[model samples]
Target: MRWEFGSILPPEVKYNLCEPEILWFNKYSKCLANYMKSIGDNHGLNLTQDSKPPKSLYIEVRCLVDYGKFELDDGESILLKKNSQHLLPRAQCEPLIRQGILQHITQ
Candidate 1:
């Protein structure tokens, strides 16, 4: 609903929802907004915008902190040391990037 209608729901949809549902939707929207505002060194990222598959399978990233011993889905482990740069699988490194442990290096 948020993706289609943005933060505010249309009047037609809002009118149909019960009070609890409305409240829940509002709370959820607020939470999502808050999270989006917190990404990327306080610069913020709009996750909802350009919602599509990545153009590439891998992304270059820099470690923001010493996360240490990250395991891949293929059972390989790699050390994530601060100030180090790596080309990592996007799927596996997304959470780390979101948490600010890794910085995505975009061209």
Candidate 2:
């Protein structure tokens, strides 16, 4: 009932959910375990025999260098800027941290 193309769109809003990071990690770990199980079953590889269980570790990190693009949980890609802090999965940023591109921040 309203066609206001000339009007500017309202600003995007964000809210704090207060969800604990550990809960999200647990859920994601389960998903990874399930996926590995399916893949092992399909290939008859017995992946669990030589591999440890999947883990999800969330860590606070600060980018030391500008990373080109990184995907968020929402599947959108964003640029990681130098000195910007972010809460991300350890698996995604561990290598970068080890390479001095990111630094783990203790809170």
Candidate 3:
């Protein structure tokens, strides 16, 4: 998986999920892998990042193929079949846009 240019998921949106980081589908997706790398470089925290925000933070991703309608840990499951396609909405990926888990956005 190589994250390139898509939409980066916000930490807040992902803050409550089980993996609660990056959600990737298909192990070889380059868009996300490269994005993760770039983010890692920016935050210092690899996708596997933890504790506080790094110069670059790392997170996990549910492959798009396996995402969208799955049962989240909140106790619900959704199914989109095997050929459906979806992308995480920009509004939903807002965490990366802000600079806080504690620091808040800098404006």
The lDDT values for all models are 0.88, 0.61, 0.37
Give the runs in model 2 whose Cα sits over 4 Å from its true position.
1-56, 72-74
TM-score of each: 0.59, 0.44, 0.19
lDDT of 2 by residue, 1-107 (tens): 01121122223311232345435544655665566567733532333333465354688889899887888655977678998988887656766887998898886
Candidate 3 root-mean-square deviation in Å: 18.7
Error of 1 at 51 (Å): 1.6
Error of 1 at 52 (Å): 2.0
Worst 10 residues of 1 by lDDT: 40-49
Cα lDDT tens digits, model 1, 1-107, are 88788899999999999999999998989999999999945757678865896899799999999899999877999999999999888867888988999999989
How far out, in Å, is residue 28 in model 3?
Answer: 30
Clashing pairs in 2: none
- Measured with C-alpha atoms, the lDDT of residue 52 in candidate 1 is 91
The ten-residue window of minimal lDDT in model 2 covers 1-10
TM-score of 1: 0.59
Which candidate do you rate higher for TM-score, 1 or 3?
1
Best by lDDT: 1
